[model samples]
Target: MIGGFGMWELLIVLLIVLVIFGANKLPEIGSGMGRAIRNFKKATGEPEEIDVTPENEKKKEEGEKKE
Candidate 1:
């Protein structure tokens, strides 16, 4: 029941996300979440940090180009 989204509620939420993002952008969203989580851990002074994969690196690069 996190954020008013329960287990089955999450599946319904995911379906909405799938409709909005489509299959192509879904992978990008997942990777972006991973990088955000990594950066968050670093900012919080967590001893262990997760590495962002190459796919995430490419997505970040694309976003920077748009700025």
Candidate 2:
């Protein structure tokens, strides 16, 4: 059971979603949901797990080290 709801209940909800949105829209929907969650976390002041520095910044740092 997931959060007290059984697997079948989850499946039913998924089916309803599929019927409402169709197959093609699912990926876009999922990505939008992910962005929403990420934004919400940021708004709540949660620290990100991974800090991504841009490639140009990394190259500059390496060049400075070499000089």
Candidate 3:
């Protein structure tokens, strides 16, 4: 068993996914998940640099109107 999943079990799960999403879309799904994981890891290592809120947006709009 690999990671508590037998080969047959893994194959069956893959077949079900293939039936649901079809063979055509698997690469797209895989790449999107890969990107999401990469971005999540990158975000974890960085400090948040800005906050944008409704109040801040309104103030900026007002300032722009005055200018």
Candidate 4:
């Protein structure tokens, strides 16, 4: 009774998916789905924090001086 879907219902859905996609394509499909979910999370997630310590600033300044 997961999310209102019984075990049999879930098994039927999985069977249908397997039949449609074929066994050979299942791994590729799974990896593509994983990548899609990962990208979706990254797109909606917050911006990364910047580190602005004095050491980092000094390195930047040294690089600029070299240029």
Q: What tens digits encode model 4's per-residue C-alpha lDDT throughout 1-67? A: 9999999999999899999999999999999999999999987795778566799888998899999
For model 4, which pairs clash? Answer: none
Candidate number with the higher TM-score (1 or 3): 1
Q: Give one digit per residue, the lDDT tens place, for model 3 in 1-67.
A: 9999999999999999999999999999899999999999999989878655689888998999999
Model 1 stretches with alpha carbons more than 4 Å out: 1-4, 46-67
Q: For model 2, how does the per-residue alpha-carbon lDDT over 1-67 read when each residue is reduced to its tens digit? A: 9899999999999999999999999999999999999999887896656559999999999999999
**Model 3 / residue 36 / CA error / Å:** 0.7
**Per-model TM against the reference:** 0.59, 0.62, 0.57, 0.61
* Count of clashes, each model: 0, 0, 0, 0
**Model 1 Cα lDDT, one tens digit per residue, 1-67:** 8997789999998999999989899999999999999999878896566766698898998899999
Ranking by lDDT: 3, 4, 2, 1
Alpha-carbon lDDT of model 3 = 0.94
Candidate 1 residue pairs in backbone clash: none
Point to the candidate with the largest TM-score: 2
The list of candidate 4 runs beyond 4 A from truth reads: 47-67
Candidate order, TM-score descending: 2, 4, 1, 3
